[model samples]
Target: MLINETIITDIKNIIAHSKDKAIKAVDHQRTLMYWHIGERIFEEEQKGKDRADYGTFLIKYLSEQLQPEFGSGFSIRQINLYRQFYRTFTNVHTLYAQLSWSQYKLLLSVNSQDKREFYIAETIKNNWTVRQLERQIHTSLYERLLLSNDKESVLAVAKKEKLPSDAKEIIKDPMFLEFLGLKKESAYYERDLESAIITHLQEFLLELGNGFSFVARQKRIHIEGDEFFVDLVFYNRILQCFVIIEIKTHKLTHQDIGQLQMYVNYYDRTEKLPHENSTIGILFCADKNDAVVKFTLPENQKQIIASQYELYLPTEQQLMAELNKELENFEERDKPKKEIQ
Candidate 1:
């Protein structure tokens, strides 16, 4: 008697799937167990509120007994983390079974409820792995998004309360490319940067934001026997438009903006379907003068965007400094109008 290869393959797949499910089930149960333990600790602490060190003593003593039976998983540090997890996620109903203990641990570090909620929503929607979620948090994705958009708009889109109406809603400015393994001190050509992007394309797409899918590299366009090459091209499903990016290792100039605009026009005229929105052009540069970008494109221009790229991840303080600077600039811009009114 012989068995078919397909039948064996199917049985193997079933076994693999079941094993995965079983692992997930055990992880979820462990999460629940920790939550219940945390809840009990909290209740006990409340009863001993008069003693300042009662909560500390409670966790310390509990860990001593539990560690002897259950090993390091019940260590003092682990027990404290479980307690924090329970307090942070008071409503077990909101705890997603899909998220593992590691993912929840990362979320617990986020201080802001709104920011934590945003990461939670994004983690679920994007099906991000723990590493990916950690990278987003380290890169300050929330702060970068808020650089161009209001907090409400950023969170609303993350939570699916509203669909993104424009590329700016989802696209990040001052994009980080540290994952490309390029040193900040090293100078490279545009082609080098483009190659690095393609090499680490997955990380690039993640950094690109929500719905972008790569379309081409050095896409060629012909106009009256003249040849033009787009550095990189992508389609953003959320905005429903083709996004053309031109990389500039140097500071952005009006010429760079004009060149990007030409590529955008070419895409809109030839590549874009009638049902699709107009093409978007982005000058992915190392640096840019905002005034130059403002005056180069039309005042009402929505199709062209100039974004700076950073070789390294910025610290929270650095992002906050940039945010504060932007706010000051906004205030300066509005002062004249207020005086007139």
Candidate 2:
């Protein structure tokens, strides 16, 4: 005898709901287990006066004793990680259930309490996955926050007390385009790079930082009788505006900036809602001349930005050097213009 269609649908729904509940239960149990382990480790370390050397032999001894009986998840490294995890999060009640072990691990690596809290809140608010959490941490999300907003404002935004005004509030210049996987001096077409980004959209979105959602690829726009295609368009709900992105595999030129400006203007005038903020345009290019960028746009320009795209994550030393150079240039530019008096 065949089941009725309605009955079958009900059964399917029940199974799906049961699966979801089971997953949540498993997650809750895992989180509780880790928290308990952390508590025990903390208590044990406190019992010993010299906690500094407490972890040295603990992992090795535990691994040797537990591996044979309990098997996997008892490695020396994992044991040490548990110790560190305990040290990082002593308050079990404060732990967020939404975040997984991997997310917590990434959070544990961050030294600043405030920064860690910021990431935790954002992760929960945005419903970011473990991989997304890792990417944000690796990209120095805290540092990016510092670069974009004032200390108090950053704190407010991180806590979800205030919404971002525009994409510029979150999108970083010198975008980390390592997801494209393009090698230096490699011969490839622009389409190939675009395809690569499309394939790795998740990574790209993570690198794009927060509040970005893919809108279209090769999005067509019409102005008067002329038609143009934008490489990628994204909508940032937090900002309540459309973000137009143009990808260029070559050095940025005056004409490149002009074209992006047109797109921004078009979105601002036509596509944007009456209450929505102005559309922002990003010119993602292989190279950009800072001097040319400054001269090409008005001093008060806020909508259009030219940024360099890197095909790989830079080493710590390299990132520091790049940041320092940019800071020095900014300071020099900020120096008061000498009076002709």
Candidate 3:
């Protein structure tokens, strides 16, 4: 009387798809409902000539009458949100069906329309949850992306219209890992930090930028009787290359850079296929002296990169300061080369 395994598997897939579809349908209906409500409210407000004081009374009256029968979700705060949601989005045709009401609410809070649209594009492409949406906004991800890229490229990447050509397009120098729940002041080993990243792997991937897929942790390599373990390994589909990450909890040195270069070479010689691009190495450290990094690697190097990790998200002022410092260092590095030529 047992069911066939093939039949059972097919039934499970069907049910899973059905559940996902049902949830999506419910979300779409809710978003549309709010949009329609906002449209009605807007039309009603026009009778009062869009007067702010009349609009306030309208929302207040509606909230009081709606609360008893409809529920607390129709409170004054939520009513205001609904009005703002429609006002922000404006056209019904532009509403994203895939986004939830909560996601839209978060997007509406962003003041810059360009930034808001970029977040929307990213959220839709990444299938991010409401919490992820909130975290990205709070971290000022839009501003950070602007630090390296232009406004057009940032929007283009979020919309998946263009792929990242080099690491600079996707790599954030000071990676924000505040979501990992690790303290910057705490004394910890490299292994401890690696473990935290592995545990929060999803958040880690999001922080890693785009097209990265985790392949291994403590990846082991062997040559004759010797063994070496890499901290992390990932593949970037967009770059068509393997990305090797080495974790160092202290300041980076020439030796650390050399070690990472060797790892990249190992992957190129052994692990990489002829059709694939050269492997890239990322040396993740707590502190990086630009002088050490510049002098350690080949001046023409493209496959090696050094980036610092931060445990906390910085304020706008702090982020701007860091951006200015990075710009200054780049100019300094370019100055000597300009003089030589």
Candidate 4:
């Protein structure tokens, strides 16, 4: 009576899968328990609204009793957080099975409803882990996207309500490269920066924006005996185009734009299929003058974009400054139209 190895292996796999599902079920149950507790606390607090300190008194008393036998999760702070969580996410139906309690805790900190909704949609769509969500939030991904696009458009793309029609809708400007571990003061060559991006390719892709897949690096092209190499090439599934990037570790100039435009042209003429959209070119430079970029390209040209790169995640002050600058630019651009009207 010999035992079959295949049967034993199958049983082991089944047990492992069952354990995983059971763990998920228990986590979800715990989440539901917290929600119920929060719901009860809110209801109780509402009834005692005559007294100003009633809510505080109720939570403190509950924590004292619950913490002894039910464990530390019912501490005063935890109870308050649970109440806040309920208030933030009023509808339990909107709570996703994929999101854990830890992830919800992070989402609760997002003050803007629209921003939180966008994060929720992205987290579910991308299957982001707790750490990934935290990183995106910490790096101010939502605010960065808003700098280049309107709020509605950004939310629409994240929620999959609409597919991106143009690169600007998805690609972020002043792209953060803190994950590359490059020093802001370091004198990096073009090759050095390109190598850093390749080394942290996955994080770079996340920073690049949605639907970008790596195609090649230092891609060589020959044009009538002239040879050129593109620093990085990517294909965006959402926009249905090839994105060619040229790295410049110095202030961008008209010549840099011209060089990137040539790469874009080459890809459009020789590589892009008829059904696909035009090839997009990006001049990823250390610094750029917006006036120079605006004047360098043709008025009707939309394929070429010049974006600055940042070596580190921006502080809140830096983000606020960028937002203010964008607002000022918008106002200035609208002034002429307002006068005409």
Cα-lDDT of candidate 1: 0.90
Q: Taking the tens digit of each residue's C-alpha lDDT, what string does model 4 give over 93-202?
A: 88888888999999988989998998998888888889989988877778777766789998999999999877888887878899999999889999999999999998
TM-score winner: 1
TM-score of each: 0.94, 0.83, 0.86, 0.92
TM-score of 2: 0.83
lDDT of 3 by residue, 155-265 (tens): 888888988776766777878899889887898899999999999999999988778999999999997899999999999998999999999999999999998888899
Relative to the true structure, how large is the alpha-carbon lDDT of every model? Answer: 0.90, 0.79, 0.87, 0.89
Candidate 2 lDDT tens digits, 224-294: 79999999999887778888888888989999999989888888888899988888898988888978888
Assess candidate 3 and give its lDDT.
0.87
* lDDT score of residue 159 within candidate 2: 80
Worst 10 residues of 2 by lDDT: 142-151
Q: Is candidate 3 or candidate 4 better by lDDT?
A: 4
Q: Per-candidate RMSD vs. true structure? A: 1.9, 3.4, 3.3, 2.5
Ranking by lDDT: 1, 4, 3, 2
* Ranked by TM-score, top first: 1, 4, 3, 2
Number of the top lDDT candidate: 1
Better of 1 and 2 by TM-score: 1
Count of residue pairs whose backbone atoms collide, per candidate: 0, 0, 0, 0
Task: Estimate, for each residue in 1-341, the C-alpha lDDT of model 1 and write its tens digit.
Answer: 87677998999999999999999899999999999999999999999999999999999999888999999999989999999999999999999988989999999989899899999999988999999999999777887787677789999999999998877888888788999999999999999999999999999999999999999999989999999889999999888899998999999999999888888989999999999999988889999999999998898778998889999876877877886787677557656564564
Clashing pairs in 1: none
